[model samples]
Target: MCHIMHIFLNIKFFTLVDFCNAISYEHVKLLSILKLHNVKFFQFFTRFYQYHQGGGFVCVTTARVCSLLQYLFIVLFSTFLVECVDYPVLFNNKNTTADGIPITGKRHIQLMTLIFVLGIDDDNLGNLTWCEVLALLCQKLPDLHVIITKDKLNELDICQRILRFKNYFVALVNKDMLPPVVNIPFLGPQPYLSSGLKLNLDFLFFWGSFSPWEGPYTLKDEYKDPQNIGKLSNSFVCINTQCHKFFIYTINSCIPSVIHFFLLCGAYKKRSNTKLRHFNELDHQLQIRLSRSYDFATRYMNLFTSPLIEIIAKSLKFVTGSIFAVLFALAAWDEDVLTVNLEHALTLMTATFLIVIVCSSMITSDDCVYMPERLMRSIIACIHYAPISWEGKAHTRAVRKEFDSLYPLTFRYILEELFSPLITPFILFFWVRPRMQKFVEFFIRFTVSIEGLGDVCSFAQMDIAKHGDEKCIFILAIDGVAFDKDEDYIANDGKTEISLLNFAAMNPLWEPPPLAAEFINDLKTHVSCLSVFLILFEHILKNVW
Candidate 1:
């Protein structure tokens, strides 16, 4: 009967006639892309219900759980593939020298010059051929260190090779081998920066926010004594090369002497270079202490410094006082209401427990911030400043629901999830099921089939002609690419181009299509010439100005 029902539904929904029944091709396409269908629709609602309650340890049937775990394992294994796991093997090449070859200073300088002239940035390091990379790595420049051994390099796939190069680049930076204006790129977008969230670091120190350190402190005389050596275990002693040899103070110390030392060292200022230098110079004990202190200060200092902190404290006190007052009122009643109606006492207790849960959730939901004000402020900020790129009532509602669903699996979260089943069905029917047509249309419109790959999203296919933007034409032209504007479509932000390059870079042996090969050549040529042009431009500007 189940098999019959499935076959009937497949015939009804998956037929060409059923697809043509939609209002228009465009409408159908939009709907298919946006809405869920078949098994995916069921999965969406299942996840919706799970998240709606508060995400927990997701449990599934034995049959389905294996499939779910299989996907999860794939994700984890993909990350592992990027890591350096292979043993190093020596490369035997007459064209490329072995690692750690003794070379003259002139040859070393030549190698450095070659690298600098190449203008290869970390992001595009993968674009180079394996031979080119291997040649550079094999040279074993005295300054630029390589962590992956020759054996590992010989066996590594493209992804691992790129990762190894990035690691090498980082090592160069750490050793101050790279010249000025060269810096490591932050791989992904930063939440605080992108979201426009302000962390008032200046106000923290500038507003006379200092409090007298209540922690243990030792005088210079006491620290000098051999008798008081054991007492120094609880203390942090930092040496100031500019001033005294060492000063003993605990974490959170704001004593005048410590403050004076901080000012002289310029440690109070938000300078990464200065801080890094000072941090490195510190003794092991002081280094550990400073690290802990900095972390603690950055995370929780706002809680203490904010004027609104007092309000939260007072509000909690007021709620506790009110609860006690209610209990007192019941105790002082002339009539024995509690005895007459014992259920009332039980109801009151239950209500209080719920209130406590709600308050605890507010406190602990966001990384144990324990600040209701902060949570409220964050929500308000999000509402006001969230990107409206996907503007629409439906989109907004969906986004808001998604944001609200994110919570740690605490007692309150568990309770919410437990009760979610009661309302999930109603929500699915009224809110989700009505939009089934949209999901169907969306999938129908955006999905494409490639030989051997079966079905995939059109976007994943990277069809430059369909989705490409014309605005990128000049940018491509600037890179020395000679292409017919009428024939070739320049991908928006060169995403398709970059994606292809990345794929080719990762799979060194994989031969690209003729068009793809031409595109890659153009891109590489552009990159090489662009770097030289930039250098010349910089030089000209410097001389002219």
Candidate 2:
């Protein structure tokens, strides 16, 4: 028996090492100790049982049984294979130096030379990469400030510089060209520059407008439009236009009113169609108010029909079912080998049946619990955003009814129709673990953090600042409709000390106004919605699977 145990341990250890080499060293060590103790205990128990048996036939039978058990253990251990799981690669070799040295003075000189050469070509100025732009800003621009700004500098120069170079800088960064070389120790290849560079630039270049001036504008003909100037592109350049004095003005402030123009255009164009005409002239303000009201109602509905609770309940049901399955297998095997009183056996079978019934009921109930809430939310979203009309309303109603009818049977249908045959294989091959969950959560959060329009805007602004101040000169490039009849002259408050360029007009649906209270509230709502969505997705993945 001891020899058999030693052979089994050797086979188990070798198999485990081959199959699960990626598992931590500590875990492998612990498994070895556990296997040794378990083998010793089994050997001792078998020997004691055989000695207590007085008959030679019984002793022989016990020895055969022990041998059979050892063979079974060897087969089971051989079949238990775990795939190696690799750790995620977070850093790359390209961004770090082998010797862990900082950027040397000689390398800095090389970068500066590259920037100067790139800046000499008017046509290629916008084509400079992110490394060239940073070098230009850090090394050359400070000394050439007078040349770029023409000695008419003031506090407004900062604003103008940002406006001019924002587009070019954004282009470079977008291509992942910034921080030309990373020489950090232990933590590289190169990661992106700090988020502050993008954020501060976005705030600086928030407002800009077109102005007619006389001088050489370096930008391409296609980029002359004001709308195209601030967008992400490598071809943006500042024009050296002549104006009487430095001033900024808001050319078109009430841009959100264009929504009315679109609505009216649709209404007039489709007036002959009764269904389309009904939605064409709907009040925008009324829709917004109703949407807000619906948002409030859905908050409470979500609380009552929380998807997380439903998912947890379903997970619990799965766990209970698995336990019952194992117990049933064990009970059947025991009944074949061991004698038991009829009354005790009956009681055990009855308890197992009751547990199975309860688990099935719980799973069924949990499966459909959140379906009503989802249907309601979907309907609300459709109505809130869609054009208001009888046709649209009818479509939404049809969707709602369809969802209601399918909710109760959906999970069962999916399981039986899609997963019935795969269930055993899935249980054998797949497992849920905390580390995998953490990796998924980290990835989601990283994605959500970078989704904002402001971040892109910021990167664009910084790109512009890196080129030079000459790119800040005013140019006439009007694209949008004029705000009023008085668009000919610059609307200034005659305050030269303060620039009007600092003010940005509010667009209700696009960029929110910078009013403190409204901005804060909107930010809070956006963050809350993002957090809820992440939680819901995580729960669904965990419980549904």
Best-matching candidate per lDDT: 1
Error of 2 at 476 (Å): 29
Number of the top-ranking candidate, with TM-score as the measure = 1
| Candidate 1 weakest ten by summed lDDT | 190-199
Residue-level lDDT of model 1, residues 118-209, one tens digit each, is 24433455465444643453343212211212222221222222222222222222223221221225623211100000011111111112
Could you give candidate 2's per-residue lDDT for residues 214-250 as a string of tens digits? Answer: 1111222333344442331211112111121111111
Score each candidate by Cα lDDT.
0.33, 0.29
Model 2 regions lying over 4 Å from their true place: 1-145, 154-156, 163-217, 222-545
